[model samples]
Target: MIDKSDVETNVVVITGAAGLIGKAFVRAVAQTGAIVIAADIDLSAAEVVANDLQDLGKVETAYLDITCPKSVDILIADLMDKHGRIDAVVNNAYPRNANYGRKLEEVTYADFSENMNLHLGGCFLIAQKFCAAFKAQGFGNVVNMSSIYGVIAPRFEVYDGTAMTMPVEYAAIKSAVLHLTKYFAQYFKGTGIRVNAISPGGIFADQPKSFLDAYGSRCAGKGMLDPQDIANTLVFLLSDQSRYITGQNLIVDDGYAL
Candidate 1:
């Protein structure tokens, strides 16, 4: 039997809860009766999100700089003190440098390394600190936000007419996230903690029509997904419905990676 009651009382921390997908995740999770802490680097934006969804469920805003160890540690400590326990954490923060989407040849080594440190490194720090905290508490859940690019080679043809090209750093970070999910799940075996990853395809963000058509041709349906599509999957992972699933990557790309 599903633990619907337990799902209602979950206290989930969603990092980067102010971004496009992050906002949807906050709304979806909040609607499920979980107390959601919408943590983000932009405090005001996160607060706006919280206020907008206040009627949905329990939504709180907190400043979270995933790149900083001190920042990650502080949020964990404060939440533990206030809530007594953190039932789950979604590592959805997307940290990157100014030159993030540069084409392959145009990307500098410094830029690549910096982007890696910001995004992948941030994911690592969050998982490391939170898993340790989960260990002490004896139970927890972790959901890392990866990308479809992580699971398959980039189809550079899709970005042909546009100035857009998949960043190599993104592929590296997200792919690493997939492995990290497996690593944590295996390492924490028998502990009441579970870890998993979500690899979403290109989200509908008003890209050029040419790019959309090109990308759409490769999908089974709806080429570009809405943020809610991914958020729905996240709710499942956080809820008891997916209790026995762990260390797996759920791709919600409308079959783009097919």
Candidate 2:
């Protein structure tokens, strides 16, 4: 049996809280009485989420640029200082305006490098910092957001007159993140810190209609999995309900891989 009270006062830091999936996670976890720090590159957007959760638990906001080591260090240090201990962290941030829909041939070196840096490098840096804190506190959870593309080939398509395709670089970086999760999980094992990944597929809500319709058609029955679906899974992983699971990737894609 899991005790909700054990986590009631614990602090959870969520990066990319302004993003679709991250916002959902904030809402779900807040209901459990955890103080949530909604961190994002966009402070205004993060503030909106924080305000909405104020009634559930203490909600705070921080501006975090995951690509910068100094930024991550400052945020982590402050959170640890104020809260005394960080119970969990969710690395849900990703580059917003990079070459997302381009193919490998069309992608510039800069584009590929940025994707790798944000997904793999940023995740590594944040995890290392948080693991250090977890070690001191003797308990923590690190949740990395991966994609279905991390484990499978990209399925390209055109929706509502706009072309949509998953890039090779994105897939490559996310794949590396999955392995990184395993590495961190093993390193933190027996130290009370758990590392894991959530690979979401076809999150279309709040997306452009054309993109949603086309992607929806392709996904059909198994195409569009709600952000709430992933959020629920995340809560379980962060909560003691999944205390025994670590170094693993949970795919919540409505069997899209099938």
Candidate 3:
């Protein structure tokens, strides 16, 4: 009975809109006629994405530093003033400083804590505030961005000669995100809000041929994925068709997790 047509019934907020995956999501959602808020810490980059998507549908750019409580407060207030309602939120961000992605031996306690606070903590803050608002309004959806690493350990063999090695913080943070999705889904049991997560595999970003070959061997077909692959799955989760789905972690990894 929901107006699933492109009638601007949904005001979707997406963090990390500057990244490849986030940008792809913005485009996909905008084309569906949702009032897309292409939010990112980098205001300029978010604006760029919003500008590109304006031709397709109603899209706006907003600054969001999810790690900061005040920034989160302002984003919600601003969105409320402009749109009056938020139908869904996509916690698709990876806020990090330079200390990330260091080798196992080089990582410090400070690095691990910082990454978790920004990534995991941010998701919590966003979900908490949105769930409260959604409870009052009586409907909402949340999609947390998780990783395939969270579902299965990394294949160290894939990075044998490449400069790429999985970041310890990422695995920990993503695992938490997946569990948090389940927690919130159960916690908001009676509320009309639904919480879910998506775990994506290695996306094709022009990696080295050797790395691609190694990774491909582990996948069902293509070793690496396109940003659109993840975006497509998100569309289904955000729509009314998925109204009955919640607290589930959908993996879009070309059978890599299997």
Candidate 4:
């Protein structure tokens, strides 16, 4: 199939548009000439991103707290009314508390449940509403963001000389998201709806040198990922390029999973 933008009805809604990867996703999709809604909890930040991409394509910003159903409904409904269609949704918004990204011992039962519920529950609600609407409209696509930790066990050695112990809840939440993506793919098999996920490896960030070297040893080349790496794959999944792919968790971890 050719580009979905060829139809002039490609409107992509990306949640968490202010986050690292979220911003990259907006830019990548905007380059394709599709109408992109950079929805996020920080409306001002989203607006800035949309404004920066105005020259590339049609981009707009809106407030959306993916963890809130009413907020999700309001945004989607408004977008459909204004754009006439919402061809795809990238579920990349993650609501985290101040104690987020804590180590295993630092994690509480409450923290674990809260994070998982916020992520997986929000995905369920958003996908439910989007799918129901898409069912009547004829087609839709969803891309959930999982993590490499969701696929393979974390290498505890990488954090040996660093303060970077992966979050316990992160693995559980991402793993749940992977299965949920699969369930929706099967659940909506004949409805022209595609559900897929991206399981990303660690991206390059300011970490201890020891941690980086240790992690690098396990990778094929680069130890960390660039936001563009994930953005490229996201565009493919959202575009007609991957119209036939569904229920797949495509990993973009620089071979860290190997």
Listing every candidate in turn, what is its Cα RMSD in Å to the true structure after a full C-alpha superposition?
1.3, 2.4, 1.8, 1.7
Q: What's the candidate order when arranged by decreasing TM-score?
A: 1, 3, 4, 2
Clash counts per candidate, in order, are 0, 1, 0, 0
Give me the displacement of residue 180 in model 2, in angstroms. 0.4
Q: Top TM-score: which candidate number?
A: 1
Higher-ranked by lDDT: 3 or 4: 3
Instruction: Kindly report the root-mean-square deviation of model 3 from the true structure over all alpha carbons.
Output: 1.8
Q: Cα lDDT for residue 21, model 3? A: 96
- How far out, in Å, is residue 250 in model 2? 0.6
- Give the C-alpha miss distance for residue 80 in model 4, angstroms: 1.3
Q: Which ten residues in a row have the lowest lDDT in candidate 3?
A: 1-10
Which residue runs does candidate 1 get wrong by more than 4 Å? Answer: 1-6
Model 1, 1-258: lDDT tens digits are 335565779899999999999999999988888899999999999999999999999999999999999999999999999999999999999999999999989999999999999999999999999999999999999999999999999999999989999999999999999999999999997899999999999999999999999999989978899999898899889988898999999999888888
**What's the C-alpha lDDT at position 31 in model 3?**
80
Instruction: Output the better candidate (2/3) by TM-score.
Output: 3
Better of 1 and 4 by TM-score: 1
Evaluated at residue 24, the lDDT of candidate 1 is 99
- What TM-score should be assigned to candidate 2? 0.90
lDDT of 3 at 163: 84
Candidate 1 — what's its lDDT? 0.94
